[model samples]
Target: MIVSRSPVGEIATALAANGLILRGGFNFCDDEAAPAAGSAAPAKSVLLVGQAGAAPWPHFQRWLERQSARIVNPLDTWSCEVIGAVAQEFGARAVSPSDRPYLPFQQWAMRAEGVKPSPLGILMHPQYGLWHAYRGALLFEEEVSLPEAHAANHLCDTCVERPCLKSCPVDAYSGQGFAHEACLDHVRGPRGAPCRSGGCLDRSACPYGAEYRYPADVQAFHMAAFAAL
Candidate 1:
């Protein structure tokens, strides 16, 4: 049984219904993706999907948790289920960050949307700052014409204060790179309360996209995840 190829607009609309944005996409001439099992054709393009900020996510995640109670790797399972369904509907292959031999999400983000890492090593979205994330990607066998790569202005370059460097209580991020042990230890200790409750001071200090800052509860959720790691 053959399925009809979905238009990009329809795909984007379908994703939006789930509070996921079709962040950006690219087409490859030489096929960046290796052929999936039993497939002769390699993926000719990829579309990035992600959440911009905390919102419907809290609600979505809550609903997901209930449905995923029996699942071991819920996020990845959910990502695959959600994205994979869309891919199956649209004649594309779905993959996620959890995939083995992990897809180059960072490389793809850079090339597709001109995204760069902030001091926190998270992709510094021009509008969303550190609050955005790439959840999954759709790999298509058909060669879709790509949009011009975004030329993101370097928000960090012009800021003289560079508050992100000094804001860390443990000085975890800087020219020395992330001091993983130092950060983890502190967050697991008593002195980490403010950070544990309010999210990373370094990340919050950034002036860009302040309006998009995740709420404290949302921040706490991520902070706990970081602590667990």
Candidate 2:
């Protein structure tokens, strides 16, 4: 027996080849979505591509090893290559989180997935916890049929301890907000060796979805990038 293929399934296959997942999507015609770039004729839908946990780390590492020269923002560059190919194949536009004039990715994610922010400001996933990220998106000129997004219970709401709020040595996160400078300074200082080698203490402290937490190496890479910024 053979199963018929669908546009969504085909796209998901392409992304999965590179260890990316279609987080979710929404049609611009849905009214709640902000109009696409072109006013006269805008893209009708968006499919977000991202990773859960360290699923993409091995794939990204292999791609990184093949680069002839040092590449800046290597992960982002690779995401564009992979997602751009799929976009071209589907006649869609590819956009990145790093794009200037910053697309409202967070807003779009909430609309598409019904996810809420964790204490660290990263959107919390019911299953993935703090262990996921939005790599890029595919914007189609015509509407695509997509299943409706269901709201998941917010993980933080039920937790009583709230370890993420108390783990940071500098108290970088609080009711006020993240202290960017403080967090940065600590990650770059002598005492920050643990965090630099592992990951953000506050982030790792989150007890929810411990199994989905990123590996130390993956976390270290991101920490280094953050410290450099």
Candidate 3:
């Protein structure tokens, strides 16, 4: 049932029909070592989907299981669980680096490799606006070649309002970049009531893909992770 193909475009089309937005896709070769070397098999392909409001994670897992796709951690691997396991294995303490919330290791991997964060990690897309997240990654056993990574097409280039930077009450984000401590203090301290209860001010301020926002609980869990760091 899992259709294997070199052209990811086909997979994107199929996932779209099933109500999942293909936020990003990439491939890694076995011959070459991973960006961070490890014993685990090198990832052949990675697909990020935005299932917001459309399906619960369990439903998505069921679909993948039916497709015979090999998920990295699957829905059973919660964010906390994955982080804990990876940290224990790698001997690196998990730390929250983003001003908004705690992002997954893969998301952080992109950043570590100098992939600038854009809305939903798709540099060119005008929608999503960093409101979405990496639900989980899927790895295939077979080789799947994908396009080379390209420079991000940031929507910030055309936005006249630049609402994301200006909308933050704590000024957590700016052109220079995110202020992590400032954001954490505001989120955990007395000043954080509005943000803690209502969600991230900066992320919510983005006009693109308003409907793709992460669920309230997901958002809170991420916020807590950042606060822990």
User: Evaluated with lDDT, which candidate comes out highest?
Assistant: 2
lDDT of 3 by residue, 41-96 (tens): 44444444444443344444455467555544344343334333333442323232
Off by over 4 Å in 1: 1-6, 31-40, 68-73
State every prediction's TM-score relative to the real structure.
0.89, 0.93, 0.55
Judged by whole-model lDDT over C-alpha atoms, candidate 2 comes out at: 0.86
Rank by TM-score (best first): 2, 1, 3
lDDT of 1 by residue, 1-229 (tens): 1124436788887787777788788777563444452156777778888888874465468657688346555556666777788888887888888788877889888888998888779888889988888889988777666568977986877879988888888999988799999999998898999899999989999888888888897788678877863
Residue pairs clashing, model 3: 119-130
Which candidate has the highest TM-score of all? Answer: 2
Positional deviation of residue 212's Cα in model 3 after best superposition, in angstroms: 1.8
The per-model lDDT (C-alpha) reads 0.78, 0.86, 0.51
Model 1 lDDT, residue 20, Cα: 79
Cα misplacement distance, residue 161 of candidate 2 (Å)? 0.7
Residue 226 in model 2: lDDT = 82
